[model samples]
Target: MSRSRPGNGHRGLDRVVSRRRLLTGGAAATAALAVSGGVLGADLLSGASRPASRRLVESQPAAETAAPRQRTVPTPAPTSAPTPDPRYPDGPFVPGPDTRLWGVFEPGAPSNIAALAGVERAVGNPQAIHWYQSWSGPGSELDPVRLNNVREYGALPMISWEPAHAGWGTDQPPYALARLAAGDHDDYARSWARGIRDHGGPVVIRFAHEMNHGHFAWAAGVNGNTPEQYVAAWRHVRQIFLDEGAQNASFSWSPNIAYDGTTPFDQLYPGDEHVDWIGLSGFNGGSDLPWGGWLEFGPMFLPSYEVLVGYGKPMMITEVACTENGGDKAAWIRRAFTDALPNVMPRFQVVCWFNENVLVDWRVQSSPSSADAFVETAGTWRQRTP
Candidate 1:
């Protein structure tokens, strides 16, 4: 499943609309507001107004004349007051200095560790392998073969746990968050947790990823799900794993970078006790469709990064990729490692590229240039300690 812009709920629309209205109304309206002398006047005519005025001038039509740029006066810093820190201080997962690389290959049989090894040979060795499994069936059967295969390849296993039986974009999810929180799925959760415990190695479980988006059934306000219910369900699952002696298994609380307007991201958080790592899913659609554009990696992740880092948890770009369409795919890949990974996202401890060909060609080898970029970037990061 992919994190997309289709169901984003117009989050950036309000800001865009407000700015457009301010600019299109012309400087005469700005002057009128300044002369009005109230909250609007105080705000617009303040020292902070230089940037806003510059943007307004730039937004004017070609035929219309714009006001000259005004001098920018530096604003004094605000007084620092002693306030209680609101962060959840105890983040469970704390990775070492080196960021782990990971990926998901083709689905079904081709997605096994052996196939992933082939990808590693082509690109470079990733420290982890990301795969998905569903809870549609009742059996507690675990895939020891695949898990062992991953370990043998010197990589860890990262599982995207889907509670619902349906595929992505399904309107109604059969498994509701209320049901899960109420212990309807406790037996299944325990069975799965025990299966992992019996396997006896470190594993990362990313349950109901992208929950902030409306596309998932477990998402808030979907199929009778709410943010509170999502939190409840997450806590219930984590407790079950703990009770089942799944100490080797760590929990990842993941949400899509963009969320539906109705539910804030903080409301969906399951708190520090239940969460080990903070996972985020983001993608650059890269002009494959009308809604998709060739977005850089930094901008796509910054919004979520700014919020999640406050929790002081180890961060992971659990799912990320840009399409090899409309723009320079090689440059995007190059910048992701050389710029975004090392500089823009210093808090991220792991990054898993979504290498599937679904929706758009997200494979690292979509072109030779892209593949080369991956190899080169992976080489640079591999020298660090994990």
Candidate 2:
């Protein structure tokens, strides 16, 4: 989905093409080499890399440092492994063999159930409900009400947790990646960790998503942030959650599909030890915007997918949609769920549809044909339950 910047007339993937060059041919190959820290690259990874001596806090046997924020009663460990639910033998939120989970993100969903239900009726029951949360905002306190609503509706709560200001602008100094790693936001991070621990259920925290895209403050080289700082910030935050015993919250590291100029995966990834799932966000803007190129689902994501799948972690297309300008949107939807999602990319366990009107009419209900196409193949995708 295009991350719509409200005040500025800019939206992700829809930004002016000249500024964010979408390279091809030899240029695309060079960029791919740069992503892997090839000789052509300036030492972007040098000095910024995580020290070889620092161990993940969870890997240690016990808490090795004092709590940086207020503490709560420690979360108790489970006495026994859960008797796996029939619908989800692997575990809650874990997709079954040959099964792919479907998720949706309506504009007012998880709070406005009536609006969310409208989408659910058009598509089948979604296995996950995707939404956003900012570190500093009026509605940011890990609201139990919102979480409960999604839980009651029988869908997993997938929160795209941004560390920036609530407005999600491109430059926010207070929420800088450096400050986050320096223990500046421990109080806030810890509170949410404790809240999830108390909630006693599964929640997917998509922290600092699409870090390769320069649309947000958290992206590398934006707002004075660097890939090294991003890695540190992620590991630091995940460590705090572990210290608080927030085992129920799973962390997903998402990046925008690797456009030519975006930051590389190796530079931003915290490591396999720090992440539970790998996620990629991509949108086909078609010919509706300046940078929108008409590419099929496979081409739009294949560059990044080739790299992320190598990480050997469960993968998800956290945000995806198509615009109706240059192609048959209905056929795209049909081909995606029917063939591309299942056959072309089997490692991707979750596919979340961006059902909003941002930039262009990206919603499946944008047209009768588009809506019908999605409904026809919706039931074929599989999901899990607690």
Candidate 3:
């Protein structure tokens, strides 16, 4: 998503993609467009591309060139933007933990993928790689063999999902995703089915995550949906997908972890039957935070993760980022992911990072060199490549 500046909210996926995660609602998977303003009021949280950095976005225009150079000095930590434009004005969306210094908005080419391998080596594991997006049809597909190859590297396809970009979740907020949730709902689900079938495996599907908050129209609170109404809506959408038979998919009930206040994970819920997993997303900023506050400070993001223990199902940091800019930037990231170790392990299934530049660039703390280490330790990580 390209930066939209102040008053340019009329665009859609066709124009540019602005991937954003809020301090409260958080962001989305590869190439996802996040809406801030308490969900429906998305305009408050994110928009299209604002600008780019020389080293991160500009250096690796394609995935092949992915890799960041470590600085002798920390380089004052980057001043990250929540949403930065895609390098190619018009290209497919691809996200991954490769050579791109700042974020995945930049496509990962062969070189970029190679850089990711280096990171995997550093982390000491390379079983599977996220393979980026799981929703988009063709290029988004991942075959069994490809899956195996990714795993050979140690990471797995920690695929992610969104309600569908048809209406409200587009470039601007307060639009109409109602139609997407209702009429086109099954169609939306079916598309995913085809992709998974094509990929040939059981996949992870996080549906209308953070529904309690209001950025996208698919959720209950947004688009004028009441809790009960939204529940019904979710049931409808989920049922349609089940009917379409995306059997290879597992459902995850993800929500923004909470930054400003403790997000009432249970209240915004659509109920047990409608969900099989739980997750959190939050980036309430702190100077003490990493990645320019796109990621929250302290173990600020941890409480929400701890609360999911009662859910019984596996948990995931569906989207995570930190903005702290002191100490070893890469080491800080390693600590962020590693420290969360199993506070979260039993309840955990996967963890992914939002690659879009937050109020600034995507990679605030991670250098291509640093990323190599992080990628190795994680079971699965995803990226969006265009």
TM-score of each: 0.72, 0.77, 0.55
Per-residue lDDT tens digits for candidate 3, residues 1-386, read 21122111112332122223345332221111211011101111111232111111122123243468977877664668334222212111121223222122112311144544333333333222332332333343334454343323222244444543333243323223444445544555566556554443334456666664555444555555555655565566556655665443455667665543323555556566665556555443334433234342235455655555554444555655544343454565655545444333334444454443345333432466456546643322222221
Task: Give Cα-based local distance difference scores for all models.
Answer: 0.59, 0.66, 0.40
lDDT of 3 at 298: 30
Instruction: Decide which is better by lDDT, 2 or 3.
Output: 2
lDDT of 3: 0.40
lDDT per residue as tens, model 1, 1-386: 43222211111222112111110110000000000001111111121333321110011111223686675986655679444221111111224444344455334322354565445556765656776666664322456776676545545578877777533344454588888988887887888888777765557788887676566677787788888998899889988987887766777887767532525677887776677787777767766744335667777777667767776667777877777777898898888777776777777767887776665677887778898998888556434443
Write candidate 2's Cα lDDT for 1-386 as tens digits: 33344311123544323223232111111111001000100111111222311100011111134556655877666889665322111111332344456788877777766676667566656667788777775666788877777755656678888887655577898889999999999999999999877765567889998787687788898999998999899999988988887766778887777766777678888877788777877777778755546667876777777766766567788888788988899998888877777677767777888887765887887888888998787555442221
By TM-score, is 1 or 3 better? 1
Clashes of 1: 0
Which candidate, 1 or 3, would have the higher lDDT against the true structure? 1
Per-residue error at 294 for model 2, in Å? 1.7
- Pairs of residues clashing in candidate 1: none
* Index of the highest-TM-score prediction: 2
> What does the lDDT come to for candidate 1?
0.59
Give the winner by lDDT: 2
Pick the winner on lDDT between candidates 1 and 2. 2
Candidate 3: worst 10 consecutive residues by lDDT?
A: 35-44
